[model samples]
Target: MRVRYLGPPAQAPDPLDGRYVFEAGREYVVLELHAESDGSTLLRIEPSRGSLAGLYNSRYFEQVSDVIPSLWGVVTLPGGGVLLGPPKWLSGEFWELMMEREPEAEAEFEAVRDEITAEDPVARSS
Candidate 1:
């Protein structure tokens, strides 16, 4: 998937938020993106036609590449799997990363985080 900034640059009070569009396969979807307090980003995807009503999709972008400080997020497909994306995304390229990441679905993600911390607490803490 290819993502590009859509609207104007971020301003004060909410410099982390940006309007972006992503080409998913053959469809281009609009998304309102906001950098979480924690280092992650929140993507509120606009529902498409014939999509499930009263249910909007949300995706979280986490820091995956450390060498250059990039973010990678995954969105669960309507079918079953997920689509991993935002590869090569950098702060300088698009937007800056916030200091604290958001705590959405913390309980769900905590499980995997526990395993990561258990394996390497020092690295995880950093």
Candidate 2:
């Protein structure tokens, strides 16, 4: 999957520090935060459309969920899985950081949205 930067670029946390799984279409994206001894949070992601109610059935998901807090975010199809991180505040913050990293890309996305709306005159009226 292409990783599109929707916000400012920020350094990605260490890979060893967290778990990340992104299943764009099949299910919800899962994030696991592992707090380090140094007071740092490790993050991990898992993509699944299935219900979290039975998440424990999956050893992988269970293991991660068991260790750290899990965050959930919905994703629209054809788009990449949403980045869900622990502590609700980080969600918006990270998105902002990502968008800041790619100002031009964000502009292009807006342009595309405008173009689509313009082409659909009926949409404009509604």
Candidate 3:
């Protein structure tokens, strides 16, 4: 997942070119996951761009799933925060929370992204 720094909600940014970019923000991350009634873990993942403006448009934002493989269920944010679950399963409220960037751990988050890109072919292709 490439880090895209969006400007504002009113304007769109350049096309992601198949890159999955989530908004940079500090949302309530689930430090741990619990088993659901079906025995599968149900985790909340808020993978939104830093802001609406940071993304080119809603269509592009929706396409985020294309870059992320459904089999993988963990996202490590630049700040070392973890987003657990599939992007499509994420709630709208979660996406909204991504509007603000968590500046405190920006460096860490970026580093993590870089590491993921180097290690994961799915992320790199996206």
The TM-score that candidate 2 achieves is: 0.21
Better of 2 and 3 by TM-score: 3
- For model 1, what is the error of residue 34's alpha carbon versus the real structure, in angstroms, after optimal superposition? 1.3
Q: Which wins on TM-score, candidate 1 or candidate 3?
A: 3
Clashing pairs in 1: 37-100, 37-101, 38-100, 38-101, 39-100, 39-101
Candidate 1 lowest-lDDT run of ten: 52-61
Tens digit of per-residue lDDT, candidate 2, span 1-126: 111112222456433322233332222223323334444433333223221211111212222112212233333223323332333324345435434655654454344334433433343445
Q: Candidate 1 — which residues are off by over 4 angstroms? A: 1-27, 50-126
The candidate that wins on lDDT is: 3
The alpha-carbon lDDT assigned to residue 40 of candidate 3 equals: 37
Off by over 4 Å in 2: 1-101
TM-score of each: 0.21, 0.21, 0.26
What's model 3's overall lDDT? 0.35
Query: For model 1, how does the per-residue alpha-carbon lDDT over 1-126 read when each residue is reduced to its tens digit?
Result: 112234333444333332233232322222223344354544433223322111112331232222211233544435444433233222222212211222433332334333322444233445
The CA lDDT at 65 in model 2 is 17
